[model samples]
Target: MRDYVDQLKEKRICSECVGEPYLQDQIEESGQEAECDYCNQTGRTFTIEDMASLVEVAFQQHYERTETQPDGFEYAMQREGIREWEREGEETIDVIGEAAQIDVQPATDVQEILADRYAERDPGAPREVEYEFEREARYTPKKHDDAEWHTKWRQFEHVLKTQTRFFSQEAADTLKEIFGSLDGLKTQAGRSVIIEVGPGTEFTAFYRARTFESDDTLQEALEAPERKLGPAPSSLSKDGRMNARGISVFYGSSDPIVALAEVRPPVGSKVLVGRFDVTRSLRLLDLSALQEVEAHGSLFDPAYVTQIKRAKFLDRLSRRITIPVMPNDEPFEYLATQAIADYLATEASPTLDGILFPSVQAGRGQSNVVLFYKAARVQAQDLPEGSRITASVASQWDDGLEPHYWVSEEVPETPKAKKADQYAHFFGWDEHNPVTQDNRDPSLKLDVQSLVVHHIAAVEFRTTPYSVDRSRIAMLTDEENRTGDVPDF
Candidate 1:
């Protein structure tokens, strides 16, 4: 008998041996039957190694028969250095023991096996998969009914973050033309600058007049003057246009100034005698006035009160000037009074390389003089014969004065182009002045020089508004009443 088998036989009696004090007492009394626990009373003997195998088999059977896993199954597997797995497609079990692999049949519980393996490795950590509902719920769609409120907020943010300093390249060019330099512009990195312009109207004029052989009406001439933006270059008059510099004077009204002054030739040059024409119209409008027109009226003839009101011309002129213009970024009002003050200061303390005039006022429909550092002039033959738009003659005035008329035409929207158009329109109107006659002989061919004004003394800005009185237009006929002094032309 194997030693282990003998030990087991001595420990317990066979089931077939009837009990007395115990199964051992029955075994002792009957001595006719010999039994072994390992063989189930077959009376077979086994080697020690065989007994150990039987013990393992008995324990495995107990583990399988239990409704739940044994409490120490994972611990015992780890202690014994054993690992269990199922064959890929079969019910047979493969066990990896300390030194070799063993096969056990019909133990194909993969999930349970994996659970045991995880439990052994992690002890008490969770073995089932978990999900976080709140984390995923964040991406769910939301509903809201206040769309207008949202839009308002969006607009607020847009203006705050993006609208402050952003403007188009064209806008910058226009601003530079006005300020005489881009160094005066304020901006942020990678952002363009927006210029908030004040509402006002500008009037411009030219000295010499021209007539085109093909066309007679002033429309072609009024529209023909090309805008000269930026500083006046030396080549400005290369094509035989008017070119002049130093200070220049401009009258604010549309009335013909030919009777007052004439463009005389250089001492030895040809006499440049031509008509005097003055064109006036609306210029830039403020932000508020840029909206759709409230009423439709005549685009010409300011004397027609309906047209003036419909276009909001007076309202735009009355708008307050509050935007910054200088390179120092200071807000300034372009009042005629302030302009005179600034001129005084500039003159009192002149800088060697600074602007000579130092300041110019952008008045609101006020009669004012412009100081041009450089301007050019040419004879009538070099330009087109401009068109003339005639309004009803102002006949309600005193009989001694000549009848007055308002000439209107479509001018460019820009300050510079509109000024150029105004200049071209009046080029030849001076010679045609009904009340004035040219002193020079009409047969002499003439060349002209630019109209020049030496100082602010040449400018005469009126504090009172332009006379809407047709009678006043006729009444103001005398030489002194028309233009105070001859501009240096």
Candidate 2:
């Protein structure tokens, strides 16, 4: 009888007896049938001894013993709060059931099994201790501290928009820290966010669009399309998503349609789109890559938790930076992004020439690129040193057909070379007009053959439509509406 009683305590528990999906699957694959001690019915199960490893792991990953607090007497003498004397953790049996999603009896049995197993190692140890299971406070597997980053970013935005725009030392320092942290962020696959653009690279060309309100404006642009279609000169530049007022930057797209969408031209307007070839190698930060940034490490590592939090924060920050802002709100809203552009272009280590971000106006997969002032300069068309040049346009059409337009540049005879004495009289004559036209660093060459003109007959908008519902309610009687009184339905 004594031997039988001892054997009953170690009876096997079937897979059906386990509640956790993973444990159930693990047991089903490896366990054999036996009479479950807790359920009292014969079923497939593992003995308590066989389940020890799994139980130990589950507790290690999800539970921590609650700390003991000072009693009321100690609190009065030590100046501790009322909470110090209050019970703090869930009951041990309740915790086991909740953590394993098991019934009360099974939880109680498991607790006894664990207690017995633990007692064997240290017979004199106390058994009155309680444990607390992690619920909402569980360590995130992805490891990003999104709340902290979000709070910091919002503070930065508020400071830039309301308190200071030009000379906020605090804001500058904060932005610098944020960017510095993002410098080496990598995707789970270990790919860097920095990308190269120029000859031989995938992103060798970009399309820019300019909308014209009238035929006259269109013709004017056709005459000097390269100059007109390129980035606006600093003086004529307006405040944009990535630039301040009077600060010029080339805003183009990998896809021409994306470029047109970005400009948001009105109906019945003409859009002149031109492709420009990147003239030299340049580095750009790829904002779209931020979505895949992740940190992978053991949950037990303290540093891994911080790493994952940063990764999650960066993923969210990418979208926040690229979200579309209405024209009316752009002045205040664009300050943060403009500041980012400035920092990446001028202050970042291994300085980037621009940023490549997803096009919010065109939806996902399509991207837009912004080249800072230094990398946005367009290379002028080469011409003879002493020759005068003129632009001409010819339009031809047959009956009931669309008119075809052609733009051509005509150059006259070159002027005779001046004598040595004549050149000596005007020293630094060549210096007066340097080789680089407009005194700007040239980085792009206009691709004349890729020029395209789009006539906008109508504008299309993609939107989510919601139905508005109206409800009517009768006024309540004074008796029924009495303060703190319940009304019968």
Candidate 3:
């Protein structure tokens, strides 16, 4: 048996000195451990005299990190230490939280990343441009595609456990019986709709209710909130014999991924599970959608099917080389290239590990085909200065002046414009003067140039909004150009 005294709050103290912050207990992002000479752990809120809590956590990790030990104290004694700390009369201050990492690169710059393709020598090559960030910003998974999103698989597992806690095993069993698959569970949904859990929402509540427990525990945990109950616990507890939190499983699947993203976790919960279904818009073997080759369905041959799969978009998704994509929109051709466009519009250059695309087009509702594009992971420093087309001179956009932005080199390799390199933005749109400098708005520029978009060589092709089939172009480096047509997205 364990005994403990009640928490007391005297005059407020600053937690920065004695420790005990909220962040102390929450697991840190992978590879990042919290460390503070004074605080027990980092916290976000500053509350009065709440510092007594540190003893509970420190009693374990303090010894482990310091001694570099292999094991921690036994649970029995660890409980005792917590009890002792609860009784200890000490004064500590309120805790404060430190800001998390931020991303400074702008979306526009990354989209304009130049490669080695050469053109008709409009300008030899694009020169480096100085960049400056006006402010500080960070990337959220919601904002861009992060392939390394979850460092540990357990992160997903824990969420399931939390939600399961909300329901009783009997309920889950009943649900399984009625729905047949977890994918089919529904709300008071009249016979056809499916239920979905939200992203980042915990399953603890569901699981707790499900686990076998003592009658008393069951009664206490399952007792409906008083507001819902009429007068007494007995009367209120049995609202048709069940109660759940934020679970509206009535919305069934047309696009399971989109439905999940929209109604999950019952609309109100922490960012517990980033649970979104993957929707896909599969590209059929026939590009024309009308052309047919083999007589009597010989098209099913593995070799023939393999050729179609090799198309740029499908191949990319198959390899997990996905980029940021507009989720659940109308179906479009070459879905993979769209993800790249999405990534360029949202994240900074080379910042994300990959992108995930959800489909909502014909034949691709709940099934998501993910593409993990690693292009963003490459840095300017990875290549020599002569070859650096996208690296910035400074690390931050707001880092003073001069080195404010990622630098783009002059394109002696392709521009005819006097100061061509000085004015180009993502996808070749000079944010400063997209009209005159980009050559897109012919009326604005002196030369009436036809701004034809193509992803070709360094001869000033300024390919805006163009995506090249990476492998196809790569093959061209060795394979003959054959028809001077680089198969671009």
TM-scores for candidates 1 onward, in order: 0.17, 0.67, 0.14
Highest-scoring model, TM-score:
2
Candidate ranking under lDDT, highest first, comes to 2, 1, 3
List, residue by residue over 1-489, the lDDT tens digit for candidate 1: 235333432432233322112223323544344444333565323322232232233223221211123246765775677854211211112221110111121111221232233345655655343111111111111121324433433443344344542333433332222223212222223211111111232223323322222222222323322222112233232211111222222211122233122221123222211222222221211222322223322211222233323234222322222232453322112222233222322332211111111112432322222222211122232333243333332346566644333334533344332223344223322444554322321111122122211111243443766766553333444785678754443
Residue-level lDDT for 71 in candidate 1: 45
lDDT of 3 by residue, 1-489 (tens): 011111122212222332222222322211123332224454333222232232212212211111111134444555667522222211111001111110111111111111111122233434442111101211111111223222222232243344443334443332222212212211222221211222232110110002112333222212211111111122222111011221111111223223233322222221111112222211111111111111111121223222332222223333332232343421222232332333332342323222223223222323232212211111111222233243322343455544222225344454343333321232233546647342311100101011111111222222349666654335674434666777675
- Per residue, candidate 2 scores C-alpha lDDT tens digits across 84-186 of 4544557666766665666776665666656555555665656554322222112111212468767888998998988888878887787776677555778
Better of 2 and 3 by lDDT: 2
Error of 1 at 82 (Å): 99
lDDT of 3 at 144: 16
The local distance difference test score of model 3 is 0.24
